[model samples]
Target: MNRIEQLLPEEIEKRSFEIISEELDHMGVILPEDEAMITKRVIHTSADFEYTKTLTFSKDAVAIAKELIVNGADIVTDTNMAFSGINKKALSRFGGEVHCYMADETVAKLAKERGCTRATVSMEMASEIEKPVIFAIGNAPTALIQLYNMMQTKQWKPAFVIGVPVGFVNVEAAKELIMETELPYIVNRGRKGGSNIAAAICNALIYELTRNHQ
Candidate 1:
């Protein structure tokens, strides 16, 4: 029989991080403070420690993301689930908002007319936002590909990007494409990410901002 530890509602998250930190230490994994914060949150969300190896970050990606959020940059996600999981209230505190255009009627129409996936068209729509934007893409490789093209052509440059789409298709290749660029990014290097993980990373950054203000 397994013994379940009792915890208060507020204590659960703190305790979870305690366990995550202990396990990381036991495994001899050492990470920079900011990286460890994001990694721990991802592990807390997925209960998978393999992220310690698979999660890749461009230099100062976490710091850049936090600064963007602080400057009221908005976030665009590939899936509604990721959009919904973000803490809108906390983001609002920093004058930021989260958006997901995947369900927009216009995006669907454009994708159909162009014969491209809605994810592809959605990136184009996101580019038109007249503000600094951070993209959190976790379910569509097409979205990542589109962003890569947009960046290469100088059509749009995001403040930061989180590319962790999950699947067996072009998921790995898409991640590689983003990693090849000089843009700031945090990507799970293989095919093991999902919308939920993407949201976890966003929320981790938001939570860090909130913690600092407190």
Candidate 2:
């Protein structure tokens, strides 16, 4: 079987529901009764994908970066919070020239200390990177738009885009932006995905893409 077909369907459904429930709770309100009726609709829309993967924490992020490196990814962008628990050492140990980007200064310093060659929040820096940008923005569509605009203006084409936005706002919008590109991409289905989960999805995408290529 292809790797995608081998994924456990039941486990995927369980994980998707858990993620959606957690995100809705975190949003501080349940959907209106009308919207609630559409719950199956949402799930059905997302589940059309043939592959699904779940990620928990830092180790997942490290594993993803390693997989991307093995697949010949040249640049990796870490767009999560500064101290979001991703293992920098694992990314460093993968032994490729990986570029890291974060929104916070302390996180950039930490990534640098862990052997990331370049770190910055500037979209201009992203333009200069020579490899595909593995972008992980935690459910912030505005931020994703900014990045997209930057790339569009510069006419820079990344090898692929892995977008993981896990939050209440613009999750779907961000996913749409990534999807519109028609590039190889990965994303979580709904809200409640924080930076950690988003990173995990990226990791899973890397694993899938690398395995497929091999």
Candidate 3:
């Protein structure tokens, strides 16, 4: 019989946290509640404990993100997958909504014409919105690059940025670029990230606000 089969589902999860926590304790891991929550969830998703180190939170990123989310900041995603994964119903409680421009024809055309990625064009589009946006980029390095450049050039900033694009190429470089900036961000330090990480962190923040406060 499997070891997990011998336990209840809740027990299994409880044991898992206990194990992860014990492991972190051995490593002397200490973090604020909000950062720890997001890190734990990421570890839960990937089953990789390295996330405890790989996860980087700009000073007070979760707190800032919560304030933006609670104030109804618009969230712009790099992919529809990230867009779909966000807890929109919960976000809407604060008058916030999610957006993805990858499917927009105008963005596509501009991307093709400018020899840039569709995500790059989409970010340019996001800049036009009147409300401050929270950028959640997960799958494209170009998206992070464009957004970072735009912020520097235009001095326009998002309410917060989540940079966790996975894979090689410019992924690590893009994340590094974001780190150099003073923009508030939560970034997966290496190439180990994706749309799910981005969505999960956003949801974690939402859950933190609605559940932790209540």
Whose TM-score is greatest here? Answer: 1
What order do you get sorting by lDDT, best first?
1, 3, 2
Evaluated against the true structure, the overall lDDT of model 3 is 0.88
Q: Write the per-residue lDDT of candidate 3 for residues 129-171, one digit (tens) a residue.
A: 8897999999999999988888788757777889999988999
Q: In model 1, which regions exceed 4 Å deviation?
A: none
Query: By summed lDDT, which 10 consecutive residues of candidate 1 come out lowest?
Result: 1-10
Task: Tell me, by lDDT, which candidate is best.
Answer: 1
lDDT of 2 by residue, 48-117 (tens): 2222222112223444544565655554444445124333444434433444455556655655675632
**Candidate 1 lDDT by residue in tens digits, 44-135:** 99999999999999999999999999999999999999998999999999899899999999999999999999999999988998989999
RMSD to native for every prediction? 1.2, 12.7, 2.1
- TM-scores of the candidates in the order shown: 0.97, 0.48, 0.90
Cα displacement (Å) at residue 138, model 1: 0.8
Model 3 alpha-carbon drift over 4 Å, by segment: 1-19
